[model samples]
Target: MRFNDVIMALLVIVIILMIIIPVPLGWLDFFLALNISLALTILVLSMFVKETLEFSVFPSILLITTLFRLALNISTTRYILSDGKAGEVIDAFGNFVVGGNAIVGFIIFLIIVLIQFLVITKGSERVSEVAARFTLDAMPGKQMAIDADLNSGLITENDAKERRKKIQREADFYGAMDGASKFVKGDAIAGIIITVINILAGFMLGAFTMGYTLSQSIQKFTLLTVGDGLVSQIPALMISVATGIIVTRAASESNLGTDVLSQLFAQSKVLYIVGGVLMLIGIATPLPNLPFITIGIAIMLSALRLTQDKKELEEQAEFESEQEEERDNNDIRKPENIIPLLQVDPIELEFGYGIIPLADPNQGGDLFDRLVMIRRQIALEMGIVVPMIRLRDNIQLDSSEYLIKIKGNDIARGTIVFDHYLAMSPGVVEGEIEGIDTIEPAFGLPAKWIRSEDREKAELLGYTVVDPSSVISTHLTEVIKKHSHELINREDVKQLIENIKESNSALVEELMPNLMSLGDIQKVLSNLLKEFVSVRDLVTILETLADYARSTRDVNILTEYVRQRLSRQLSRTYFPFGKAKVVTLEQSLENMLMEAIEQNENGTFLSIDPMTSQNIVASLAQEVRKLIQMGEQAIVVTAPIVRFYFKRMTEQSIPELVVLSYNEIESDIDIQSAGMVSI
Candidate 1:
């Protein structure tokens, strides 16, 4: 179809024909020249390629060229056996290249064959096999690294995909090379066989059929055979060398020639030492000192020039770096640069200088990797996607301190001693160990900072030993759990709805904008999240809201209905063993709150007197303390009508108290009244 494609097809046809048909001496010379030219071009191209992938088509090209050379060898053998002459190309190589001696020419051809077969071909084959094995072995590790970078927000999804594709391509390239090296090895063996056959057969045909004497036949056929062998073996040698170069080359940004020159001559000091050594040898020996002295002086001058060039390059790089820094400073001074500072990361971690190694991968720290796992864990447990956390260094803080922030406000801060283990008492210790006393930043549990060597001793004493990074990560996890509701907004709600719409489109269309708006649903979900309820079961929550939304527009009432529908989930979270220890209000206090519910346009409020409100709060606080003392959760169970008011009235004073209505408890769970509050 295209010009290059047509030429390639025709060239392949010609190579096939060369093996089946006879060629004149003139054409044989031309084909011999073409073969040599092709081999030389391939050798040069291999030296200039930046990486193996840049010349991915080389394996096919190698097979084609090897076949073409073998075909030419066959055609030249035909002419030599029948006529005792191949072509000028072969004759010139036989006479001029080897001084017109058949013995010398044959010896030289044997040397070329030995070099290509034993050295280049064998070595390249082994290297290709090793490279293929290593590439495949390292594939899993490279894939995991890419996934870690993607999860940590260091690279985008597209970047991770591209990296994975590149790794696969490298593996394929090395595998192809492993198989391609065999072609050159086989070609070398075939060349040896063809040369031996041509010499033996040529002698027989010339002495018997052509009627020449045995000596004359030997002389004439020997020269023709040696010349043909040399013509083919020289090009084969070049190709074998090229194959070795391709397989041995490492992936670099520069071509092979540039890389070799730069690395080999990088240090001028080595050259100067060598030149001095040569001059001393010349002076010590009784040889001609002038020759060695002249060469040494030239080497010394080249070294000096290289040193000057390296210095100029370094100076140029430094000057460019300074100019770039100045440009950045000028850009920072502009008012437009201040706009970015106004926007805050949804979640952020700021560390002091001493703790910087905890986030640096080069220092054997896995903080970033741990953070990626934390996000995945939160999604599974809380049914919410946590945004990428921005980690940075804050020089204003103490060297051992770090802080976690939400919406630009610090929610949790902790101090850790680097190069030490935090040994926390696991409720019981067999004996006391020598260490610095401190508090576990996540739970305020008493802990001791122990030396690295003391970790085993502390663990043997029944204490939980944790590293500094783990301690900080645990604290950050707890803070995120506490502030999850604040992190979610209307956009998150819309995303959840859209995800559900994929499987339940009709349900979403019927419920949204008809019975309630998106904001209304956001409020209901937010209310559920405030008490650590996972809204991952959006189908159930939305169905319940759609059923009750038409009767009342109150978000609190709708959330209560959703909770009742999700009683099994809530019961499992609070009472994993199917039993709940709760604190109930007395009948008189419940009745009093029920009567105080005054409804108006702004919604219902508790219209109780000051003494009544104070007594209610005081009695609940006393009961909460008793539950805490007994190591039981403080849950307040009341009538559904008064549950909202009761929680709203005492939420500020007793935030840890969980207020649940009778309808919100699952029927199968066993309920135990641990305490009762009376006003």
Candidate 2:
């Protein structure tokens, strides 16, 4: 066994022996001294530790010490009642500490008991109860905060896990403390009972059984009983005080003593005022002036010295800060410093200073939390992991302006009034509102920045009103959706495959590492996402890819086959409750495109004439605009052989339009031909 473990086992045996066996006077004195030393050690340690967690073993220590003290009380009581002399430690305390007066000793012991039971122990118990309750109540909020930090990339997974463990430990510690305080309270009560029994039993045994005179018996036994009570109660009082300190100590980087000193004596001016008040009282009051004047002068000198020390420390810190800044500037001039500057966030939001309150929770803003939800929402809607966006403040922009950037390039910018509501007309407003005229950054709709009080009026007038955070979040969501294809890389594809492998290992193993490379799958998935197709159904997409991947090495063909397999998903998404409204190419134009197509092992490319390509694009653009104006999504249906080339042709002109092959539509869904594109 380890040394500490063996010692603890021996200590437990000793405590039991003290309770069951008769203890010699020397041993009783030794145990009493040991108890006092242990309690004193605990008190000093509690004062020095920076935080409660640093002394997490305190609850167990409290129970063990309480038991040890009880055992000692039993042994001392046996010694006093049997022989009328407990120990030399008790004798010294009885005569020297309390002037051999039983009444004075008992009063002092009672004072210690009352102070511990009523003040320190009671207060510590209440604080522990409240701390435990608050910790449990705030657990959900704390966990959510940790998740927000983890999701926002402020902390790593390991850091978040460690923080969660710390929170749990704090809760458990406070709960243990809530129970441990009861041990101290019970110890105080037991001490009182033991002291009373020792006095009554010791006197009877000394006078009647030992045949001593009444006055002699009372003197000897009363002194010993009071002395034993005082020794036990003093140590108990120290422990109770320590318990109060531990429970009441807030978490800080400094120890309790240092924290108290720094905060209580931080201001020299307060000390000066106190010293001045003392001096005035000494001169005015009809009492001894010398003592008060001397102490007041000492306080004034100490305050002056503190002021000087504070100034010197500030000057030293200033010098160190300047030196550090110079060293940093020198380091920044190095090539290594420039290397970090080259690395940019994949997605970022830069806002002006005025918008900081919209992001900072301390200022009643929840933009960071909102952004976390935004990322999750986009992942669910677009079926891709949106990268963590870095939020920062820039002073070069207008105070109310914010911009979204993808890959170090600004893609969208918006401006909002800090404390005003953005009232937008959904289609038309019932009445015009008086406010600052502005364009809504998310949708470019006409909006007015109105007072918060006007929000009800705006809503009553059939206008949609939103706060600044919602405006920024909505803009960021749209920007992410538009650039999701660019965000997916080989790592994301690898992650998806690995996640799938956990449940369908055989299928993933058979398809990956043998049939297609990771890059090839990433390309196909990126191609699907380029048209805003949800790749959430990975089992189906991978299965379709595995079937056709061996025959063709082209990623585009694989993506097209996957799309054909996912036609049902597409049909439901686009045509939720009605027929699929689509525009189709004329037979002549389709044949012309087929004839112009050139195929190779690499891929298919349209080798059409310039005039023919222009005419086709012009005709398609006209029909696409018509469909959009009628509030219908523009989808072009073409033959399976020409779908790829047709999409490629009209991609630049109508990027928002979706082109599907004739075979890609499900047979169950009704189709409506809105128009036809011809050249």
* TM-score per candidate: 0.58, 0.61
Query: Which regions in candidate 1 have their CA more than 4 angstroms from the true location?
Result: 1-17, 23-27, 146-168, 213-215, 278-295, 313-404, 407-679
Model 1, span 617-658: residue lDDT tens? 999999888887888888889988888889988988898789
Lowest-scoring 10 consecutive residues by lDDT in candidate 1? 145-154
The global C-alpha lDDT for each of the candidates, from Candidate 1 onward, is: 0.86, 0.87
Please tell me which predicted candidate would have the highest TM-score against the true structure. Answer: 2
For candidate 1, the TM-score is 0.58
Residue lDDT tens for model 2, 1-679:
6999999989888898878998788877888999999999999999998889999999999999999999988988888888888888999999999999988988988888888889889999999999999888667646755664554344557889999999999999999999999999999999989988888887788889999898888888889999999888888898898999999988588988789888898889989998898888899999788988888898899899999999999999999999999999999889878888888888999999999998899988889887787777767666778888999999998999998999999999998886798877768768999899999876677889999877767766767777777778878877888788898889888888888899989888878889899999999988988888989889898999889988988898899999999989887887787586789999998898889988887787889888888998899988888888878888899998889889988888778788988777778878888889999
* Cα misplacement distance, residue 186 of candidate 1 (Å): 2.0
Candidate 2 ranges with C-alpha deviation above 4 Å? 1-10, 150-161, 305-348, 355-401, 407-409, 412-679
RMSD of each: 10.7, 10.5
